[model samples]
Target: FTPLLLENTQAYEAGKTGTEIPNVVHGVGVFSVIGGSGSTLGLIIAVLIFGKVQAERTVIGISIAPGLFEINEPVIFGIPIVMNPVYMLPFIAGPTILAAVSYILMDTGIIERVCLSAPWVTPPILYQFLATGGGIKAAVFTAIEIVGLTILWLPFVMISNKQNVSEE
Candidate 1:
């Protein structure tokens, strides 16, 4: 993920502008599997903090630790976001919106391009800082992404909780 985007940005930034690739790569990391591919960390937080469903809360509780390490398999499969239609919209939309926003910020020079390479499991805020070579702006942008994702996921979580309650 980082390599392709990083290479494109580096090439474009190095005065080799032939293709239409923009000098924006770090944004990929901003939205990548942080808290899981769909930004499930936000979803997890939503469940734990505001979700009324006991089962959902338990799933989130069990998944939170792995989520912190950027592992979302449990939440993804456990919360069943993988095929559940209820969570489909926010699951896709959250990361897409965050990526678009992050890209715009980076393109406009609000945040720096990611020049450093870090492992995918580096965690969220810390990953941004290390990937951008200690740029605080990257970390801040990551924080914004997290907040944005949280907001995006909140509605779906509430809806799911409501459905669960009515069914019970």
Candidate 2:
């Protein structure tokens, strides 16, 4: 994704001096898949910290380990985020916003372009640094994205918890 998106940008800047090298696409992987699509690490944390329903908490507890490794089958199938309308908005919006922010940061040279691909399961902050060739800015940016997405997930998780309580 990064290579492809940057092709034109890279070409345009090839042999050019004083032109901003377009590296926005490298950010897509870092931002979108930092903790898996939708930044499920944030979702998992939101669930564990605020989840009131025993069932949901149990599912999230089981999911956290895998979520850290960038595998979210447990939460997706267990919490069944798939086909669930309630989580639809956050699921879509969180990654989109994070990716957009990441692109802006990389495009503006606030953070370095991701020059290497880490293993998919490398984990968040560590993965960010590794992917960006050891840039502390990448790790910091990742932390910000994680926290922002977690805040985005917070209210939704709380509302779901309240609904579960009411249903019981």
Candidate 3:
């Protein structure tokens, strides 16, 4: 993920245009809350697959917004998440499951959406605080999402490793 993001289009543009990665990428703003550009990219990819199409669409738009924290478009457009065979399985399956779970939780009042529209680039704690009205549950859920993304991404990692081995 680190290497990919480094070589990703946004990074490339920065290098080409002579802007730093910080500015070229989304998130990283002043007076912002709820930021995690990397994780949000992962989350959105996952959600795009699992969520109602509209949910995915909504996140995408928010990501494109200039001042909004979600700045997911850079990673989405830059890393070019879709084409990698390594990502296809996880990208499609992981978020669907996670997003569905989040949706269920929200629907049943296990969780609620944010009132503050925190930045997507914000750390999980801040995001949780802002999203959950300053409750610890949001942080807990964010941690769960991280763990879930790891678990969700494992199969792809394994497959990629196996493929590399076979190629050798």
- The top-ranked prediction according to TM-score is 2
TM-score of every model? 0.84, 0.86, 0.51
Model 3 agreement with the true structure over 1-168: per-residue lDDT tens digits:
334334433443444322222221111221122223334444443444443334334545555343135454553554344576665665566555655665455445464433334444555556656634454655676666766675565555455445544544
Candidate 1 matches the true fold with a TM-score of 0.84
lDDT of each: 0.76, 0.75, 0.45
Candidate 2 per-residue lDDT over residues 1-168, each given as its tens digit: 756545534543363211144455755767686467767788888888888878888899888888988888888778878897777789888888888887877777787666565788888888878766677887898888778878898988987887787876
Candidate 2 has an lDDT of 0.75
Q: What clash count goes with each model?
A: 0, 0, 14
Q: Which candidate is the best by lDDT?
A: 1
Window of ten residues with lowest summed lDDT in model 1: 14-23
Clash pairs for candidate 1:
none
Over all chains combined, what TM-score does candidate 3 have? Answer: 0.51
- lDDT string, candidate 1, 33-125, tens digits: 568788898998888879998878888889988898789999889878988999999888877877777777767767766655777787889
Cα lDDT for residue 153, candidate 1: 87
lDDT value, residue 22 of candidate 3 = 22
Q: Tell me the spans in candidate 3 whose CA falls farther than 4 Å from its real position.
A: 1-80, 165-168
